[model samples]
Target: MTPILLIEQVLNGLQSGIMLFLMAAGLTLIFGVMGLINLAHGSLYMIGAFAAAAVAGWTGSFTLALAAALAAAALAGCIIEMVVIRRLYDRDHLDQVLATFALILIFSEGTRWLFGSFPLYLDVPAALSGPVRLPGGILYPSYRLLIIVIGLLIAIGLFQLIARTRIGIQIRAGESDREMIGALGVDISRLYTIVFALGAALAGLAGALVGAIQSVQVGMGEPVLILAFVVIVIGGIGSIKGALVGALLVGLTDTLGGVLLPLFFGLFMDPSSATTIGSALASMSIYILMALVLLFRPTGLYGRA
Candidate 1:
């Protein structure tokens, strides 16, 4: 591959990694602080996409659409927490998984009912629709670059939020000892709701941003959600720092493997066979990385023993 092509692929990897971080961050936070295994997290992602699509279509404003997506997802998360999730806090993991899985069905069917079976397309805003020249004479899509910037900014913001604020202290305390915090007069229930809604909002924002590039449709979030889970597992289930590192590692490995592996194989074999075998291996690269990591760390890079 040419230098420009390599640069582009690296950027693509970075973009993919950052987006996965957005998904995984919320997941890790929820698990770490609330001890909830929410299978319906992906449904929240889908809700964001649909909300953005619907609002954008009606208002013809991308900004407004994004706001709507965040609001809708957060509201939905709060409602679900209040009505169902709160009850599951003390339940076994199996029960939590089953209940959230049921929620996935409800969300999927409800979305289909409202949006019909067709996919919704979100147009990239006019201002960000074109490509920009990068440092190495490489032209990159402006919107994708924006995603990278936004993702990084959010990461920084999250770090600050969790490290510098009063809420952050409370969150950390809750994670360490929920019962102690509650005994000290903290409204643990309200805090849980806030964290859940915050997580949902993050997922929703990811879905909305990604929907502009990919088709907005029912079940789009499942594949991403699965990847997000891999990210958290590889990063360490309760570690945001682990999520960031793991996401970037998975993204780079997957993207580079897909491009470079085929080229490497083509040197020794027929182009067709090389392409097929390379693609297959490329798809499995991240899982292989995960297995290797687990073999050593077991609990993941940042997970506690």
Candidate 2:
């Protein structure tokens, strides 16, 4: 591949990493603070996308769509928490898993019922629809660059929120000891709702942002949700730092492997055969990385020592 193509793929990988970070950050927080394994977290992402699409269709404005998406997702999360998820909190992981899985089904069918099976489309805003030239005369999509910027900003905002704020301290405390926090009059239940809502909002934002590039439809978040799981697994159960590193690792590994492995294999085999073999390996690259990380640091890179 040409240097320009390679550079483009690198940028693509970074964008993908940022997207994964958006989803995984919330997943890690939910797991860390609530100790709840929400399989339907991806559904929240879907909700965000659909909400954005509907609003954008109505208003013809991307910014308004995004705002509606965040609000809708946050509101949906709070409602779900109050009505269904709260009960699952005191239950076992198996119960939480089952309940959330049911949520996925409900969300998928509900979306289909509302929007039909046809996928909705989101256009890149006019301001970011073009490409910018790089130093090497390579052009890159402005939208992808925007994704990276937004992702980094969210990461910084998250770090500040969790590390420096009072709510962050309460969340960390809740993670460490729920009962003790309640005993100290922290209103652990309310805190749990807030944390869950935040996670859901992040997931929603990711979905809406990505919907502009991909088709928005039922079950759209499932694939990314699985990748986000891999991210959390590699990052650790409850560590934000781990999620960031692990997401970037997975994103870059997956992207580079898909591109470079074929080239590497082509050196020794026919192009077709090389592509076949390379594709399989590329798909497995993140899993291999996950395994290697686990073998060395079972808890993940930024997990507790």
Candidate 3:
């Protein structure tokens, strides 16, 4: 209702969208270039959170925790790519899906066993722990603001890497014609591994950054993973630009719908019924957006036909 509240919600949406973009960016890249449906991607997210929490606990420093998380997730991704995902490239999507699903089970249970089903807590670094006053005198969490800044920076960096760098050129080429790149001595196999690991690291970073605000627990990445899928689907597969737009759209839709839908319904319906029904519909809003996007552009807003 209030302008400040509305601004706060927008910030929330932006934060959520950025995180979704981080997850979706890698997902789209993997699907576009490698043609693998990695259901285990969420598992890498969880691994990163756990790794960060564990390292932070041991070292009492968020920086070390983040470093450990990124490295661990990236390393894990490389191993998975080399040992498990490599065989699936030549196989069907169903096979890749099933294998990755199994990987989720292994990762979840392994983490539970190691961490003993207890959730770990990550603290925002002391420097980033407070609130910053924004224009119009609204205060926002520094950590959340940091997330937005980091996400945008990463987005820019990714754009530059893909558009300006040699590796980006190779990645584009590989996406268009893997065989041609292989023939050109691009080391397609190694590239695939590096891409997977890079994606894993991004997801890991998302988990670590988000873990500071939420509990570091098992299966935390699943919901975000689903949302990330929706984001990429709406944005268009294999398009980073699409992923960024789609993620923001989803974030704003989900956040605003959750807050505003119930209010709108309460005007005409009983308050209790409006709250329940509105909540349900709000949760479904992004999927409906996805459906509409698919209706008009099945490949996504930025995805190539």
Candidate 4:
């Protein structure tokens, strides 16, 4: 591939990585603070996308759509936490998994019932619809570039919120000892609701941003959710820094493997065979990386013992 193509692919990978970070960050935070394994987090993501699409269809404003997305997802999260998740806080992982899986079905059917089965389309804002010229004659989609910037900003904001704020202090303390925090008069239940809502809002924002590029429809969040799991696992569960690092690694590995592996194989084999083999290998690259990481560091790159 040409240098320009390589640069574009790298940008594409970075965009994907940042988006994954958005999903994984919330997942890790919830897991760390609540000790809850939430298989339904992806449902919140789907809720965000659907909410954004529906609102955008009505108002024709991306900003309003995003606001709706955040509000809907956060509200959904709060309700779920209050109604269902709170009850499961002390349950086994299997129970949490089964409960959340049922939620996925509920969310999918509920969404279809509300929006119909047809996928909704979201238009990139007029200001972000086209490509922009970059240094070294590279051109990239403005919307995708915007995603990278927004994702980075969110990352910074999350770091500051966790490290520099009172709420962050409570979160860190709760992660260390929930009973202690509760005994100290911190309303642990309320804190749990806030954290869950915060996580849902992040997922919603990711879904809204990505919906502009991909079709918005039922079950759209599952694939991204799986990748988010991989990201958190590779980065170390409950570590935001690990989530960011793992996401970038997986994104680049997946993007570049698809492009470069085929070229390498073509040098030694027929084009068709090379392409097939390369594609298969590319699909497994992230898993292989995960395995290697686990072989040496079972908990993940930054996971605690």
Q: Model 3: residues >4 Å from true position, as ranges?
A: none
Q: What TM-score number comes out for model 1? A: 0.98
**Each model's TM-score, in the order given?**
0.98, 0.98, 0.98, 0.98
Model 3 lDDT at residue 218 = 92
Q: List the residue pairs that clash in candidate 2.
A: none
lDDT string for model 4 (59-163, tens) is 999999999999999999999999999999999999999999999999999999999999998888999999999999988899999999999999999999999
What are the lDDT figures for the candidates, one per model? 0.93, 0.92, 0.93, 0.94
Cα displacement (Å) at residue 24, model 1: 0.5
All candidates: CA RMSD in angstroms?
Answer: 0.9, 1.0, 1.0, 0.8
Candidate 2 C-alpha lDDT tens digits along 190-258: 898899999999999999999999989899989999999999999988898888988999999999999
Cα miss at 239, model 2 (Å)?
Answer: 0.7
For model 1, the stretches where C-alpha displacement exceeds 4 angstroms are none
Q: Which candidate achieves the best lDDT against the true structure?
A: 4
Q: State the weakest 10-residue window (summed lDDT) of model 1.
A: 166-175
Q: State the weakest 10-residue window (summed lDDT) of model 4.
A: 37-46
Clashing pairs in 3: 236-300
Candidate 4 error regions (>4 Å): none
